[model samples]
Structures are given as structure tokens and as C-alpha cells.
Target chain A: SQQGEEDPQALSIQEGENATMNCSYKTSINNLQWYRQNSGRGLVHLILIRSNEREKHSGRLRVTLDTSKKSSSLLITASRAADTASYFCATDETGGAQKLVFGQGTRLTINP
Target chain B: NAGVTQTPKFRVLKTGQSMTLLCAQDMNHEYMYWYRQDPGMGLRLIHYSVGEGTTAKGEVPDGYNVSRLKKQNFLLGLESAAPSQTSVYFCASRRPGTGRFYNEQFFGPGTRLTVL
Candidate 1:
């Protein structure tokens, strides 16, 4: 069973736009992580928001967590062609041996 | 440092064939995992190892086996390939941390497998 589900299966936006992807999870998690995967490549961790924290920022990436709602969102500001990729949300259930359950992911395409 | 590396970037197998996928990490991480990705579905864990000589089944553990004989290496074996098993496989590693959310997995270039 998928613990996390990302909304907007796919999105296309113009360059310089801000892209936001949302993820909802079922169980309580220690943390929620966002990862990016380029075509035919591996996933790269982008940012993580802890259960206790409401939001975090890293460079152009912003992550927000609302544990009460069991949801998280990733905001990438000023999107560019290089930002085109599949974004996934992963959650690690508390006391679950650190195993991460990943979401289906939202494929984002930035048009030049 | 070649954080994580997987062998046989791509492979083709026939039904009932047997093969092994190798994953190695240089970060001296204590945890390693194997995941498979299908068309619309996201990556599903097949198996994982928390330490040397320790392996555990994950969400989608059927049709696969894993070994973590060395701290730096993990192996995934397919005793008999099936058509449905064709997918992209990924290996990830992370070091143990004091806090549960302190560690983030580092992934290797995936292996694309096709079972005809």
C-alpha cells in the first residue's frame, strides 16, 4: 500500500514560474522527504521537513509539513528547464525501522 | 567518491533465466536498499539490509532475494526472471544516525532490466 500520494500527476509550466507539488500521507511520519529524478537517472534528495517543523528552505526549494493534515508540499521557485523531472514525496513511519514509503510522484515539465 | 554504484546498468533476460544485480557504496553506510519502479507506480522496496549479513523483506519482496555480506556491498538476485519483473531497479544507502529523520538515502544510477 502506498503511504504517500502526490497530487497533480503531471504539470507543465513556463520558465520562471513557481511550481508546487503536494503530497498526502496516511500514517504519522518522522519526516517527509522530496526527491527529484531525471530521465533515466537516479533520484536525488531535495529537501526534508521534519514532523515537528512546519517549513524548511534550501536554496530555491521550500518544503512545508502539516502533520495534522498528514500532508506536505514542495515549492520550487523560478522553475527552469533544468527543473524538469519527476518529483516524489517519501515518508518514514515513526518506529518503522527507517524504511521509506514513496509516492507515485508528479512529473513536472518546464517549457522554455 | 562514487557515493553509490550499481553494476550492469542494463540487462536483458529470458523467462526463467537467473541473474544477479550488484550494488556497492563507498560511504561506509550501514543501511542499503533495493527498489523497483514500474510505469505508473512509484518505486517499491524489494528488500533492504540494515547491516552486514542482515536482510529484510520490504513492500514488494516477492520474486527477489537480497544479500548484504559486506558492509559496502549488497546483492539482489532473481532466481527465475518473469516478464512482469522487467523494470528499473535502484539501490540506495544511508548511514545510521542518532535521530530517525537525520539520514537521507543516496541513490545509484538505476539498472534497466527487461525480461522477454
Candidate 2:
């Protein structure tokens, strides 16, 4: 079974707007990571938040993790048309050579 | 520095034909993984390697076989191709670290395989 499940399988917004995506997991994970994938390309690492950390920021990207709820959310402020891609959340149950289970992903479209 | 790379950007195979997919990393990462991406299934791990000459089965490993003979290269092999195995294959590598933290993995461009 997949460890992570992302809500709002698809989303659309205008450029410069904000986009929020949620991810829920079924198990206790050591850490969770977010990735972005453009069509016909490999995934690019966005940010990673550990279970001990509540929130993290990287430029326009913000990530929040609630270990108690086994869930995480990624927020993109001032979204750009280039940000249009499929966003995925992956959770690692343990550390050191751990396997990452990814969610079905949320397809976000940023219209210019 | 060519973080991760997979050979044969695209391939088409006939049923019962066998082929091998190669993944190489230049970052000296100890953990290597192979995954297949399908529409609704996301990315499912086929096999993974913790270190050289070590391989382990993952969530969906029934039809896939993997080997990591060298420290920097991981190979995924299909003895007999099946139509069901058609999907985009991705290879990733992560450097080892301690504590309860997630390590960012570098991914290759991916290989699109079609079995007819």
C-alpha cells in the first residue's frame, strides 16, 4: 500500500496566486519530502521536513509537518507559470537507506 | 557533476524479450533505487540497493531483478518482458546519513519503456 495520499488530485490557479497541497500518511515517518516533476521529466527535490520540525521555508515554498496527524502541506506563494507541474509528497518511514513511498500526486496548473 | 544518469532514454521491446536498464551516479551515494511510474500508481519501487553487491525487494518487486555490483552503478534487469511492465523507469541515489532525517535523492531523467 502507498504510505502517502495527497488531497486535491488536481488544481488550477492564476500566476502570482497561492497554491496549497496536502499530504496524509498512514504510518509514523521519520521525515517527509516534497518533489516537483515537469511533464516528461524526472522529479526535482523541493524541500524536506523532519517529523521533529513543524515548518520549513525555501524561497517561495513553505512546508509544514504535523507528526501527530501524520500529515504535511506544501504552500507555494506567488506561483508562476513555470511552477505548473505535478507535485508529489514522499515519506520515509526510517532513516539510512530507507525506502520512500510517494503519493499519487497533485497536478497544479498555473495559468498565465 | 552529473548527479544521476540512466541509459537509453526510450526503448520499445517485444513480449518475451529481455533488456537491462542502467543507472549510474557520480556522487558516491550508497543507496540506489529503481522505480516505475504509472498514471495513478505514482512511483512504485521495484528494487533497491543499500550498498555495493547488495539488493533488496521493494513494494512491487515480483517481476523485476536488480544488481549493484559497483559502488556507483545499479542495474535493473527484466528476464522476460511483459506488456504490464511498460512504464517510465526512474533511478535514484541517496547518500547515507544518521539521525531521524530524510536525505534528498537525486533522480535520473528516466527511461520510457514500451512492451508490445
Candidate 3:
């Protein structure tokens, strides 16, 4: 079974607006990482937040994690047309095969 | 530096045909993994390697086999291709136990395979 499940399978917003995506997992994880994939391309790492950390920031990207709920959220401020892509959340489960399980992803469209 | 690279960017195969996908990394990561991406299915792990000569099955490993003969490369092989096996394949490599940041994997561009 997939360990991570992302909410809001698809979303669309104005270029200057903010976008939020949520991810929920079933098991305890060491960390949760966010990635972006433009159409027909490989995934690009965005930001990662560990279980021990509550929040992290990278430029316009903010990530928050709540272990009690086993969930995480990624927020993008001032979204741009170039931000149009599929966003995914991945979890590194505890004591597993050193692999990360990815969510189905949220397709975000930033209209210019 | 080329973080990670996968060979044969695009391929088309007939049922029962055999082929191999190669993933190479220059960062000397000890842990390597192979995954397949299908529409609405996200990315599902096929196989992974913790180190050279070590291979392990993942969630969807039924039609695939993997080998890591060297620390820099991980190979995913399909002895007999099937139509159901067509998907975009990705390879990732990671270094474990890094302080402050962990489980940060480098991914290859991916291989688009179609089995007719």
C-alpha cells in the first residue's frame, strides 16, 4: 500500500496567489520531502522536513510537519506560471528498506 | 557533476522481449532505488539496493529484477516484457545518515518504456 496520500488531487490558482497542498501518511516516518515535476520531466527536490522539525522554509516554499497527525503541508507563496507542475510528497519510513514512498501527487496549475 | 543518469531515455519493446535500464550516480551514494510512474498511480518502488551486491524487493516488484554491482550504478532488468510493464522508470540514489538533511535522493531524468 502507498504510505503517503496527498489531498486535493488537482488545484489551479492565479500566478500571484498562494497554493497549499497537504499530505498524510499511515506510518511513522523519519522525514517528509516535497518534489516538483514539470510535464515530461524528472522530479526536482523542493524541501524536506524531518519528524523532529515542525517547520522549514526555502525561499517562497514553506513546509510544516505534524507527527501527531502524521501529516505535512507545503505552501507556495506568490505562485508563478512556471510553478505549474505536479507536486509530490515522499516519506522515508522508519526502519524500512532505506526507500521512500511517494504520494499520488497534487497537480497545480498557475494561470498567468 | 552529473548527479544521476539513466540510459536509454526512450524505448519501445514487444512482449517477451528483454531489456535493461541503467542508473549511474557520481555522488557515491550507497542506497539506490528504482521506481515506475504511472498516471494516477504516482511512483511505485520496484526494487532497491542498500549497497553494492545487495538487492531488495519493494511494493511492486513482480516483473522486475535489480542489481548493484558497483556503488555508482544500479541496474534494473526485465527478463520478459509485458504490456502491463510499460511506464516511466526512475532511478534515485541517496546517502544515508546525513546530519541536518537526510534521505535526500538524486534522481535520473527517467526512461519512458512502452511494451506493445
lDDT over C-alpha atoms for residue B5 of model 2: 98
Q: Give the interface RMSD of candidate 1.
A: 1.6
Stronger candidate by DockQ (1 vs 3) = 1
State how far residue B57 of model 3 sits from its true place (Å): 0.9
- The best candidate by TM-score is 1
Each candidate's TM vs. the true structure? 0.98, 0.97, 0.97
lDDT of each: 0.93, 0.92, 0.92
Arranged by lDDT, best first: 1, 2, 3
CAPRI verdict on model 3? Answer: medium
Candidate 1: give the clashing pairs: none
Q: Among all windows of ten consecutive residues in candidate 3 chain A, which has the lowest summed lDDT?
A: A92-101
Q: Rank the candidate models, highest DockQ first.
A: 2, 1, 3
lDDT of 2 by residue, A1-112 (tens): 7888998999999999999999999888888999999999999999999888999999999999999888999999999999999999998885434789999999999999
| lDDT per residue as tens, model 3, B1-116 | 99999999999999999999999999988989999999999999999988999999999999898889999999999999999999999999888664345667778999999999
Candidate 2: count the clashes: 0
Which candidate's DockQ is highest?
Answer: 2
**Clashing residue pairs found in predicted model 2:** none
Q: Is candidate 1 or candidate 3 better by TM-score?
A: 1
Q: How good is the docking of model 3, as DockQ?
A: 0.62
